[model samples]
Target: MPAKVGAVKVNNVGNSSVFNIGDVYSMSPESTAKTYAGGGSFITGDGIRIRLGQSTTYVTDKDKLDQNIT
Candidate 1:
């Protein structure tokens, strides 16, 4: 599974990320490709980086969808 950035803290994303404590970010699945939100920057623990609120970014699509269908 890919790294699913969810309702997690920015600091938790990367041990040394600029994402401050209490900074909530919108996360998207691997399918959509990009995942960022309203104007922010985040760095992964391993250095993978992404910026929030950038056009063409997929972070704006933050909504709980049901993947498990009966």
Candidate 2:
């Protein structure tokens, strides 16, 4: 038996992927997490408070974007 798909709609796809009806031979996935924050509370005067935001860099391999699968 084979997979039967109807009215398939792909909205968005990101990073390296193997989207199809088949089996994958090999795949290497890597992922990591790092956070940085200022030691302070969410209490401030009636004004815009300056705070440091957390961010992460996406992994890339030469040209293609590596899929950081967990």
Candidate 3:
């Protein structure tokens, strides 16, 4: 099983003006001391869904925004 390294929360309702449909985001832990990796997901109020892994590239539609952590 993958270890739980960190947690993330996406707040679209709080900043709806800056967020849009199909927007994607990713997050990871700050420390690399642990051998296992971590990831998370969330669905925004605008029907935008985001899925993330430890080390993966984020892609989205042309009209959407993509944010990821290296």
Q: What is the C-alpha RMSD of each candidate to the true structure, in Å?
A: 17.6, 9.7, 21.9
Output the lDDT of residue 58, model 3: 50
Q: Tens-digit lDDT track for model 1 on 1-70?
A: 3354557533345433344334346633333233444433443477565554445545343665535333
| TM-scores of all predicted structures | 0.14, 0.27, 0.14
How should the candidates be ordered by lDDT, best one leading? 2, 1, 3
Q: How much lDDT does candidate 3 score?
A: 0.42
The runs of at least 3 residues in candidate 3 whose Cα sits more than 4 Å from the true structure, single-residue gaps closed, are: 1-45, 55-70
> How far in Å is the alpha carbon of 25 misplaced in model 3?
45
Q: lDDT for each of the candidates?
A: 0.44, 0.55, 0.42
lDDT of 3 by residue, 1-70 (tens): 4345455556544422343334337533342221332343333377565554355535435754345335
* 1 versus 2: better TM-score goes to: 2
Best-fitting candidate, scored by TM-score: 2
In model 2, which regions exceed 4 Å deviation? 15-30, 40-70
- Backbone clash pairs for candidate 1 read 36-59
